[model samples]
Target: MSAEIKQAKCIAVLGTGSDVGKSVIATALCRIFSDRGYKVAPYKAQNMSNNSGVTPEGLEMGRAQIVQAEAARIAPHVDMNPVLLKPVTQIGSQVVLLGKVHKDLSAAQYHREKEKLWDTACGALDRLRAPNDVVVLEGAGSCAEVNLMARDIVNLKMAAYAKAPVILTADIDRGGVFAQIVGTLACLNKAEQDLIAGFVINRFRGDIALFKEGVEWIKKKTGKPVFGVLPWINHHIPNEDSVVIERPEAKTDPVKTPTVLVVRTPHISNFTDFDALFQVGGLAVDFVEHPIDLSAYKAIILPGSKSTRSDLFWLVKTGWASKIQAYVKNGGHVLGICGGYQMLGTKVRDPEGLEGPPGDTDGLGLLLLETVLKAPKTTTISRFEWDGIPGLGYEIHMGRTAGADRIALGKKSNDGLLRVKERNQQACTEFDGAVANSGRVMGTYMHGFFDSVPILKKWLSLLGLNELEPPEFCGPQGRDRQYDTLARHFEKYVDVAAIVKVTNID
Candidate 1:
């Protein structure tokens, strides 16, 4: 609401801490404003995650922004998320600036370059705001980290730059709701505290009336409005980070449905690929960290990973490798995707040290293929088919795979697919992925492979779960519906009119 802020109005959602629902709140705001006839776009200065998606221009960014773009009914762009940090090791991360890999930098080295990166982030935000009616900026992690405040470009600094009003969000489910908000405000200086328009409490379970006194106490203590208390939603939305996997859900009876176990690796990436699988009736998807009895499940899935070699090493060291092999020998089916695909091959060579130290490692040897981790990464919106079943997916990988007697999953093309669109208007006709001669094992570079209805149906049938029916909506259509539902759920709890007023949007 400052004269310096021109063209688009901006409102930022900053969390008290990580996984406190900043992305979800920002996403709802995008859809709400879009529904109100405003052209909305989402911006996150820096995102640290390996769960990414490719844009129509064949650029890569965090998948959370892609979901936000869809909620706004617009095409996604790299400008929406300028800096992405993909942790490849305990000490270092692959820094992606403006949708491309800039370099691998350690924590200390990355901090030294913050000044330059901050400028880049600001430029991206300016570009995003230029053509939009409103830009919903999302802050990463805690907005009140005292030590990181000076170096922070995503929270208060970015908000101050945009002259955007901030709505501090906290998860009541995490407990200490009072302390969470009060302590956060206490950490900020007076000017920063004044920037906060109000507070939104998320993930409140149980009776709302029971918390009325608590809400009143917070309002009086902070001298700020409590916008609303959001109830925990049971629906599935793609998580911006993998931390959600640590918070376990209520156990479901495995006997009622055929289960698919996903080997939860240390560095899991793009695990959202299984979101579609979770929706299929009579099928349950579980992420398992320890080696479990695979006999109870219909099939096993090795999801994508940031450090393929390291995770593959984990599979062997943790006893999952032997268990998976035994399951395959018992005539069980298995599917490996991206880094997982690399692990299923005969050998994986990282001679150039793309993932780690220069060397070679033996794969699970399920497929007669070899993978070489080499230079420039491949990121594309792809179209393909599997056993004549049309499919749509995207490929994001850094290695070239080769094999003979490989059953082609699909030949990539510019057309003839259901969901994915042609990138850069170019036609491509390359074959991707492979299937074992035994037909029990398959591997693909494509993420979102199961998003295709026909492919999901066929795969289920192949796994002997023929009785289960595919959901009414699948892929993009289904995902869009979920976003709309999320928006509605959020609106029911939050004060939308007050939020609009706070943004000073006409």
Candidate 2:
């Protein structure tokens, strides 16, 4: 699309393992490049798994790319996430376009269709390269799976096609960070290996002084510079992968502090919906395994689930159904988003297994309506004004609910959906422990609703809590100050300047 294809510079970030902080590193790199005044874009050729977001153009992309784009302070682009596969079953998944699910196909079935997806990926990357000084590409999972490597469009093939240099990141905490990097290089074909510029060691939890010998061992083994040994940052960062976000055993605080239980279920996508809750002061958030008591919490929330029927089944099996109902019956507040919102209703129907074949599943009976899964999924940003709440939030969930005459969280536009209306609504509305119905309970499909001050305050008031202060916006000054804070945390162990130097404009 541009004459500068030959001149445009790019870099690919690949991980030695999943959940090794590759997305975190890429976002940090975006901030670094953006701070230097270079036009930068973040890209990921193909992203499998669930956890998607709708772009400004009304197209769908992975949520991780959106975070990286925010780091660059750019409007999210669809081409940034060329292919998204949201699994509907163990072997089958729904193929998505820029933001909507186009069709459902098995893994083997989808491979046959990848050529068309690859063409779209290339087109998106080409557009990203057209107007930027640098495009940082993030790879999915390990690049060493030889079997899947042939079909891989997100990692090596994407790097080759983009003509971008690659930097492999291996997790030192996994043990054998050296072997992971070396084994990866050994596995790749020579051309793929040649694309690598160097590697970074991520999530090192020990004394950096102790790793000097191992660092030397890696250098002598691969002859490539170990760019940085980054220590783990305990600071709050967005969890890009839903799987990691869903399980918080390690990150969860063990103290018997005031706890809010998140009911875990099958098809749980977008667990990041509760990220703010995780950091709420004077409160602890934990995922309750089955057979656990729900009566112990001051509040309970059911997050978005991919399969309403299956997750509802899980709720029954885990005995959380009766427990949740009992909690509400005893005057506790319950909140649900997306599929979780559906489960809070009267009933759910799937005639086709868009989640599964033909059945009507009973809801938790928390809300008054019913939800029916449709052939085409509903994915969009809902802007609404509810009972006086304001601010701008987005909705990217499927299925529809009925029977509730009014929205408790947000109002509807002509387009029809709930979104943030006021900035302080999240804080003011939920402060000092205020509950909507008081006797029953309340919830909405809006994810970032609590980010609003009023809404947050009102919700907290219902539970007898108070907000210390409003959350800082995720803008340039805010992110800069936050990232600087993060950098300081890593200053003692990580090679901060070296990371910036690796991504610096030439």
Candidate 3:
């Protein structure tokens, strides 16, 4: 290390378990520090998530880092999230090294390359630290996994490397708050224990005052401070993990409300695509795993998938395909995004065995479209318009679709659903997506389709749900509001001043 060169004071937010509000806490801290006039950056050495996003530089990174960057009021960069592991199968994941596709590897295969990944992660962290006043580092899953601790690049190992103060965040809402904290500490050595400056009890429900003794006990037992007990808040903040969608019943009942059924495919990817729709009042969004009566729902959304072919097979096996086809026949609207969009065609060909074995699978044949799964995944920030109603979104797909415009259905809105004006910040007149069967069936390669208020409103009008719609922003401004809300929530409950002091940053 150079004498004059200084690295940013890093704060490591490690979790007791996955989805323990680590990402949200890190995001809140990012906004809090940034608001205090510090140049704050969020870093995650590696993130295993199907929920990923494209950066302004046209690079792919975990969406969690993107959310934290937005909270910090900075443009998201690839360095913020250097390594992303997107799960394609139960045992295999498509490794994305520094914002580019690397290779698909199984669990054992991935661990073998951990050494190289660790070095890259460290280099990226050093770069991020060099220019920032403070960097908020987030950990993946439980930090005290004894078996995998040696190869852990994003948790305790990374925290120790940066010499950062770790805030061990535990979820109280899941119960066993004491066991969660104490058991985690029992697994770590004294040196690792010293790195943990304090704790944050996340998702604490009911009266926080009642938990004062609980906090005191944690401090007494561990000899470390309990910084705060974060309240259980149900906010519009988007989740970066697929775990949120695991319980399909979390949202309102599809049968009772004017609901939208999102077919929960086994390999569902980018599940956050429908968060905007979930916010609309008087409307419910339900992820139904099994086939159901589609007569009550206004629309059906087939979301993006990691294994499109596999999920397609599941759709058929689970009887969802027949139900969807019947729904479409009964004048139901079906909109597919990304991999889902690829499945709405007449046939899908994978000659090079990219998606699976080199073969052909018959699509739903809802449109005059055929697709070929190819290499070099399309990941770009896109600007487009739906019938002149402009919108902004991104694309991440591995298939090329051939929608024949010559063969059109009479008296139906056929062909491209979006007229693209630009892609990857470059100007080009291009049409994307396909629509057929009287505008009831539409498919687009673009994600974040509902983020644009105008486009959302237009769709609502088409579905006759415009009158029941609620007001909520979905882009940068909307996210900023949520960030501010989160910061405020933390400030109200947590000891913000003490956290700053722990960082020791001037």
Best by TM-score: 3
Off by over 4 Å in 1: 1-6, 242-244, 247-256, 404-424
| lDDT score for candidate 1 against the true structure | 0.87
Task: List, residue by residue over 28-130, the lDDT tens digit for candidate 2.
Answer: 7777677778888899987876677767666678888887887787988787887888877889887876666678889888889889888888888888887
Could you give the candidate ranking by lDDT, starting with the highest?
A: 3, 1, 2
TM-scores, in order shown?
Answer: 0.94, 0.87, 0.96
Q: Which digits, one per residue and each the tens of the lDDT, describe model 1 over residues 82-157? A: 9999988888899999889899999999999999999999999998888999999999999999999999989999
Tens-place lDDT per residue, model 3, 29-63, is 99999999999999999999888999988889999
TM-score of 1: 0.94
Lowest summed-lDDT stretch of 10 residues in model 2?
426-435
Which residue pairs in model 1 clash with each other? Answer: none
Off by over 4 Å in 2: 1-7, 242-255, 385-387, 404-436, 467-505
The runs of at least 3 residues in candidate 3 whose Cα sits more than 4 Å from the true structure, single-residue gaps closed, are: 1-3, 249-255, 404-415
Minimal lDDT window, size 10, model 3: 406-415
